[model samples]
Target: MNRRHFLKTGILGAGTILLGNTLSWAGEIKRDVPIFGPDTKTVGGKKHTPFIKAPKKVKAGEWFDVEVEVGHYHPHPNTKKHFIESISLWIDKLEVASAKFKPVQGAPKARFTIRINKPGKATLRAFGYCNIHGLWVSFPTEIEVV
Candidate 1:
């Protein structure tokens, strides 16, 4: 009837319902809130690691680039059945931005240019979801602003 109700029901069912062009529910089974895997996995001879590329140090008021890529070491399929759905960027526990992709027409990568005006230690993290493999998160990337 409602979205929450639908999601709740869908999560309990053995089928996945597409939530848009970007998200889906995989059966009625629930795992941890955010699912992540090891740094490297040998799937089909390719390494599927959620890699975050950013500067180790930055100026307080300067703009810098941050790139979030899935299967950086290995290549993930970009087909109708298996592909990355979305990639999100987070600073500490605060979500800063997100990007979504369409299967067969999109790659599992996103680039962000951001400016932080405070000098301190900042924890950067990334989250991505695959159509068939569910969710995956990156190991934290810590940056220093001076």
Candidate 2:
């Protein structure tokens, strides 16, 4: 075969392999996205879902404490095999804070002091990730900023 033809074939093969790997990685990300149920009545939901604690009303521009705890009702496992990995807090579709925990040492909980500058309704949500159970999201908690 000619040198030019061989080089062209090699480049095309490398591109195809990279493209296939990219597609496979994207599929894995889609499957790893956070999931949640409508409520926490089930055992799996209670163990994996994150619960948010905040005030019902707050003044604009004032910082307040927001607590996010994974498995508020039912405690999740803290062993090396199955444990909570991280916790994140989101306000109105924007991620404000996050915390990471080591297995068997740190708990999946965080406190974020945040404030909104605008006066309107704000929605707060928490996301929790487990080593075994993947990701889980909490129900939205709405607060009014006067």
Best model per lDDT = 2
Model 2 CA deviation exceeding 4 Å by range: 1-34
Clashes in each model (backbone N, CA, C under 3 Å)?
A: 1, 0
lDDT of 1 at 87: 86
TM-scores of the candidates are 0.71, 0.76
Clashes in model 1: which pairs? 11-28
Q: Give the TM-score of candidate 2.
A: 0.76
On the 0 to 100 scale, the lDDT of residue 120 in model 1 is: 99
Q: Give the alpha-carbon lDDT of every model.
A: 0.70, 0.75
- Candidate 1 lDDT tens digits, 5-97: 564345423222221211232222244443434345346213344789999999998989999998787888899877888988877767788
RMSD of each: 8.3, 12.1
User: Which 10 consecutive positions of candidate 1 have the poorest summed lDDT?
Assistant: 19-28
